[model samples]
Target: QPFTYTTAPVPALTSLTPTSGPTTGGTTVTLTGTGLATVGAVRFGATPAASFTVVSDTHITAVAPAGTGTVQVTVTTPGGTSNGISYTYSAAPTLSGVTPNQGPTSGGNTVTLTGTNLTGTTAVTFGATPATSFTVLSPTQITAVVPAGSAGPVTITVTAPGGTSALPSAYFYVSPPVLTGVAPPSGPLSGGNTVTLTGVHLIEATAVRFGTTAASGFTVVSDTQITAVVPVGAAGLADVTVNTAGGTSNPVSYTYLPAPVVTTLIPSQGPVSGGITFTLTGTNLAQTTTVLVGGTPAGFTVVSDSHIVVDALPGAPGTVNVTVTTPGGTSAPKTYTRVGSPGI
Candidate 1:
């Protein structure tokens, strides 16, 4: 009787562990399925892998070979070539930094990544969120626009032909700062006044401004404290804002006071002897009105919401209006002429 030899059928590879790795080699790949016992060679696409060992009838361990793009692994045996297997060859690109780590929730902001193996990048993502736009500027650089997202921090990932690199250490955070109040609500038009800002999420304040004018100087003390110099501005109320790495704060009003203006002097004629009833009319009068005679404040009485009566001292007979001063500025003098007799 003649001895008979039995041949096992080649197995079909269902999948490959870490189906992808660098073209530089040193990656172990496990091929699985029913007929791996007779695998003559493990080929990554048309190129043969570095080495391969048959572990069992259903498993084979193989070292990845250098290549780019997708490749199929096939096993050859006495029965002929088995079904084709597929794997991707990629270069793991690292991300050193992400410029402008923060962006608007609406996304669409361009960001630059710096590191090696960045060429042939296939995809860019912010955590699980995919970027809206991306471009491979060079082997060591990438430019991608952020997609809209919620207010929070997210890890960025870059994928290339070698494989996805480690998740970037830098993160992207999206949130706008909030402003509540401004100290010393009023300031002179000359600027240079220090004002305190109170708000939330002010940790990375970059710029401060009164209206359209940027603050002369600014310091971020904490997430809720900011001191800034008021810029020269027109007389009136304008919004104040602080910009930070997170975002811009809500605007708060900063009042700018202009020099007061005087219109007329009631009882323009007064007794030279002093102690006469008179009224001064002017805009922007101070809350506490003062009667000034020759630049000297004399005794005065506030008679109404917009009126004041003064008892002048025995000074040289002359005409001068009572001037008022306030945070808004000094008011023009109201002219009062001296009369022959004292009148109420």
Candidate 2:
């Protein structure tokens, strides 16, 4: 009897992954199915793949030949040619927009990536840093977490099996405006003083606030500085903040110093006696540094922002001007009349 030899079974190609790549080709596709061990050749439509390696009876890695559009990919072994699966030649990716282009330096905000040919996006990056994570929602959208970064402008991009998006696609990593301190942190309650704010990431500040009052004529001096005309606020510690597209900064305190205003002087016509205690009534007198009766500095005590007590100073007088001074500056004087003693 003569011995009979049986040929190997024909291969059956079930899938090709990643199913798509750039038209320039050079994509390595994993071909999976039965009887792949002896894959002698791989064909994308009628064109042969540049190269192919059989990895197992059910796997082959084939380097795609340069091509365009979609085509059927197949494998052939000694047994026979396998069934065909589709492979797409994709166009270069394009970016349309990026949501919330600005985020914190620590980078944790969920940003939406919008563009064309974004399906199968393998990576999203800010500058050279990859996103924390990302999910492809469709051919035109992906959701990604911004990666940690230093402050200021950075370009953001997306990458797919096809290609990476291009630059000027704006992205910013900001350190929300910091208010380390303000020059001249205390100002007159009536405002109108130029104050310099010092900190980081102060570029393009949209608004400056002193407590609840908005600053006027505010200028962003640089990435870390701003100059603003202070706004009137109640006499107290006011919280100052800067706002930008990135975010609002932590507040720094500014104290509004109320200017003293003299309203009355008890015994406005006191005798020239140098030891008489005089009660002073005024607005914002608490910080009274001096009480002057006709150019004489008298001993004084501040009772409150609106009251003070001072001992009169001896003065040669018909009528003398009395005034009070505080950190906010001096008050207008009230007249004190002195009567000369009757001559003997």
Please name the candidate that would achieve the greatest TM-score relative to the true structure: 2
| Candidate maximizing lDDT | 2
Residue 213, model 1: lDDT of 85
Q: TM-score of every model?
A: 0.65, 0.75
lDDT of each: 0.77, 0.85
lDDT of 2 by residue, 85-145 (tens): 9999888788888888888787888988788988878888889899899999999888889
* Candidate 1 TM-score over all chains jointly: 0.65
Lowest lDDT 10-mer window, candidate 1? 282-291
Which parts of model 1 have CA positions greater than 4 angstroms off?
Answer: 1-20, 23-41, 45-75, 79-89, 102-108, 147-154, 167-169, 172-174, 188-192, 234-236, 267-277, 286-322, 333-344
Instruction: Give per-candidate clash totals.
Output: 6, 2
lDDT of 2 at 284: 81
lDDT of 1 by residue, 1-344 (tens): 99989876755878788777787766789988777677788888887879999999888899987887778888776656678767876667887888877776667678888878887787898878888889998988888988877777788898876767755446656577889999888877888779999998887788998888899999988988999988899988999998865566789999987755667666677677877666666655544445577678787766554566566655566765567765555676666676565559
